[model samples]
Target: MEATDCRRAFPSFDEPALKATFDITLVADKELTALSNMDVKEEKILESGKKATSFNTSPVMSTYLVAFIVGELSYVESNYFRVPVRVYATPGMEDRCKFSAELGARTLEFFEKKFDVPYPLPKMDMVGIHDFSAGAMENWGLVTYRVVDLLFDEENDNANTKQRVAEVVQHELAHQWFGNLVTMDWWDGLWLNEGFATWMSWYSCNSFYPDWKVWETYVGDNLQSCLALDSLRSSHPVEVPVKRADEVNQIFDAISYSKGSCIVKMVSIILGEDTFIRGISRYLKRHQYGNTETGDLWKALSEESGLDVAGIMDTWTSKVGFPVLTVSEDGNTIHVRQNRFLATGDVKPEEDTTIYPLSLALRNKSGKVENINLDKREISIDLSKYDASSAFYKLNADQAGLYRTLYPPERVVKLSQAGADNLLSVEDRVGLIADTASLSVSGYQKTSALLDLISLWKNEKEPNVWMEMLKRFGAIRKTWIFQPESTTDALKQLLGELVLPKVNELGWNFHAEESLLQQQLKGTLFSSAVSSENDKIVKEALSLFEKYASGDAKAVHPNIRAAVFGAAAKYGDEATWQRLVDVYTSPKSSVEGLAAITALGGAKNVDLQKKTIKLTLDGTVRSQDVFYVLNGLSTNVAGIQILWDWLREEWDAITKKFPANMGLLLNIIYICTGSLATPQHLKEFDEFFKSKDTKGFDKAVSISRDRLVSRIAWLERDVKDVEEWLAKHQSSTKL
Candidate 1:
């Protein structure tokens, strides 16, 4: 049985007295070993030609913590006292699984040290499942992991993937305390459970692996997914009400995971890090093996830190969306205001009177201040406090707070001029640059400033910071004001001035036997320069691509592939697109190959678009490929007819084979039905939409209303149309 089905098959109460043993028996396929949560009390090769391993009853815990997996399992087994520690995965993935186990051991060790308690469970077995629906699960003593989330071969794993695996394992292990031990009383406190664990996981990873910049990545990259959703009008607070299991799953999104974790980070920042840890330790001790609500956490925190935890968290946890901190300074005083910030083109913001629990940090010529409250909607800090009036001042300093900043155009210019000399964090710098791009600045001037900022980061920052800056600069490079040639030069100049320095300074060498390209890849984008004086950037990237494509090739980094394609599609030869398509269609293609296909299709290259669609016709592509081809095809006239006809002729077969994958197809169908509808095509798509004998129409509508249509709204940037679409689809489009 599937895990959730197992929960339903044996329902039990959450009451303290309700404890019982469960004996589950299922035939295991030959590829895997049968395993469960407790000690191996019984093991027998049955008459049915199956090996059955029965685990003794576990401690009373939440049903969601239960796990079972069948896979080609190799194990690294040990013991912490009587409790066995076993980590298992598919045979080839054992080394990375071992690393993951190491991370878990370290985290468990830390928790044991910090919590002043012994390891509670009698056995801990972590198994990496090939097709897990979520990242990882904390199942009392039996944690299950996604293959990608657990296995990390040191010799083959990229720096970034290794770090991500470590953090994912740490996060799940932490749940043994925050979630599995002291459960949330209801789903409204789900954020507290998830958020606390997410934060602690990163904290633990950072403590173990300092170079990873785990927190920065979590803030800049992952947290944005949550913020993007939360910025929508339909968003709820991190701590949201979930009266049913379906409702509980709905909040298991970026908001509950990343943004909710960010809030915990903010709490750590606001109250000192030690204070937050002390509070959490007190919380776990107070509620050990019991259930707790959001308020229970607040009570423990308040008692431990002697802070007004309730007042602060209540405003943040119950409120929907984040504030816009608009800061301005004169010769005497600095002004800050609390307001909602929708992206510049967003329509119909909520009522303006809602207040955000604003955390303020002021850094003059000196380092950052502890914390100040901008409790009022508009508050001013007197700049007469022993520093120059025009000193570097950053709002939402160090990205500690969860709001967007509204640095006006003049301030952008000033910061651009200041460059890396300013004290803002890399994320804050990214926000500043993005904010500048969104504002009403002259395109050429913005380009120059962006180039300057990019130059500053390349020259002075770490790899992660450099990557963030490259992404920001690359994002706005192709705006309407600059010709592709001009943008290419600017990119070239930015990349050109830096490659040799990086190669020589960082000792990135490529010998015949040990090419740098053979290194396990990291990151998900690539780019290069083509200046007359610095063409090595382009040449090296192309060389790497070619080397990576050779039969004995190293695994090409996802970031490198994205970067190469992005660079090539913009300015590299047209032949580069053909090479990409060739690799994508090849039988040797992996998931990265699919990603390249998606990126190329998303690039809006007409020829590349046709090639992607044609791949599906060969029946060599995955189901997702069909969706990408369809989704990409939706925007164009030539492919739209092909798409419409396919929907008409093969709609039933497609839905029958892949019901869950039909949503994006239907969404594209919906949009095309409205605009490009022929009476015949419209009838077909409409019938397909209405004739859902399966279980995904609401999901289809949700996809359209939440992701697809919202993107179209931004592309169209027509406020009235956005409002009309929202009105028509209010029931289905809750972000």
Candidate 2:
């Protein structure tokens, strides 16, 4: 229904602004149930002994919101909201719908309160579609989700699974108001729908479960994801022009979802939470059952805050990339310079034209935040008045801006020390790590500097900070995937040293009373330790995996089940691989099946890798789940080459299989080619796609190529720097 696909269903003016009321009627077998965007108004027996169900006329809505489904479905209902909320699935999976039904009802109620609007529809029905291409479609009152996103088992699924289901359910529910009620005028304003929904989902989720600390994770997950993509030359503006349907799919990327939400978050921070929500509520009320451009939202926000919101936000949305602020200090005044940032570290003068409205909220030892804006290329600020001692000052406090900060190398060390002394917020620590790592890759700082900085965080307590550090290390590891065996071993040793203590401290046990973050941290540390090939962790993982594979249900905790399977696959023989395949063939739940598929990609043996690849093409794996297997393979050194070769050999058959689903094909292309880091790989990628007509996925291919070029340049520029650092600090512990 999204991105102008409604015309494929029926003939009508399919653009989003062309709103109409739909009278949907379905004729199905008498035993099957029928559903639409509205409640059923009448039912009768058809002449052919089938049932004919006619739904009430829907409210004035876009063509995409019209939906009708006839299937043998069962549902779990909840009375938590004023209107009936139900989660439906196939007959056998009714029990799994209970969690989503309850969560969905609560989320709808939360949105209704926050938006200052009641649920406009009579009933809210969410269904699990077996072969869904996207995560979920917010089709007016009838939302459709992939089975995995809407169904959950509290006992069998891990903490990550629970969080994912909650976020997805909440995200789609949010669109009920943002997308369905107040629609976007055209495809260019798609972010107006997606970005607001993404931001609202996190806001409501945090309110519902504050202990989860979803905001902390947002820095590492959402902020960093968008920054990575937006740094590329192939990236587009947030409000990109989309004249055709083919161009729309490419904009449904990190820039629109992650970067777009980041812009919303930055504005909220500037305006204060209460004021921001008030403005959003006002916008929704004024535009209910109507279409809007991006300016409509800005006008409402500006009126509420008494500021030129449009002036502050237009460049951010209309521009293609963000800026990096380089900070230097002299006596008391600190000079800050802003320039367009690119991952390749080679921004030409022509490309550095955008003067973004930056939020330079400076913080120091006194815990006072100065709200300063830098609209020019450079600015100087005197901090002596704020902090006489000049202990430590950080720009872009809490990383609220859509820009990165580059401190002097010595200042970076001081920030690390400050973090160790508990003087920085979790967001500050994460931003420091993210910025330093990115700077190192782009040659703004030496790779050794980043190595030294992360080496000091072994005792860091926060899970989010550790997660950010691990991701940086992972990027370095991937860039140097083709390095000498000794170099790779040294990198793994460093990783093992950083994570082993945490692994031992947390142990491999779960308790109901432990916080969700604690459970997630334990799992992350254990998996990382195992990946580093530590003897003790690998031995323990195999032992648990052996017992679990032999039908002992309690041998491994659900929290670390994937890690155990991955360890066994990475280090075991053919027998272990076969055991994992059997588990994939017949699993207790969909979660277990996905875990097995992902673990199969970690198999180091060539024959095992081939076997796993074969399973993806055969009927054994669902087409919708093929990306899981390919993504797993992309992480393995041996499997990376194997996956690219397979993708090349099977491109035609793959395209034929997924001709209609551009999003899935785009994911497959990324999984197959995104990890390639060598110049030779880039040449080969270009040669292969040069002749192919990549009309639907041209942007994906361009991004992949651009990423490879950046990786190759980074490696060529910093190989000696990384190698020397690793050699000097190489651990005696063997991988």
lDDT of 1 by residue, 359-395 (tens): 6765554655546777788987775563525656666
Residue 699 CA error for candidate 1 (Å)?
A: 8.6
How do the residues 1-735 of candidate 2 rate in per-residue lDDT, one tens digit apiece? 776677888898998899999998898999999999999999999889999999999999999788888998999999999999999998888888999999999998988898899989999999999778889889988999988888998777888888888998999999998989999999898876788888888998899889999889998889999899999999989998988788888788889999889999988987898999999999999999999999999999999999899988999899999999998888778889999999999999999999998878888787777778798999888887667334688887787888989888888888889888888889888988999988887879888888888898889989899889988998998888898988888889889989998889879899999888889888888999998999999999999988987889788888899999889888778888877777777776677878888898888788888898988788788888899889889887789998899889999988887763458888888889978988889889989999999888898888988888888989998999999888777642334
Judged by whole-model lDDT over C-alpha atoms, candidate 1 comes out at 0.58
Number of the top-ranking candidate, with lDDT as the measure: 2
Q: Scored by CA lDDT, what does every candidate get?
A: 0.58, 0.88
User: Which prediction has the highest TM-score against the true structure?
Assistant: 2
Q: Model 2: which residue pairs collide?
A: none
Name the TM-score of candidate 1: 0.76
Lowest-lDDT window of 10 residues in candidate 1? Answer: 515-524
For candidate 2, the TM-score is 0.98
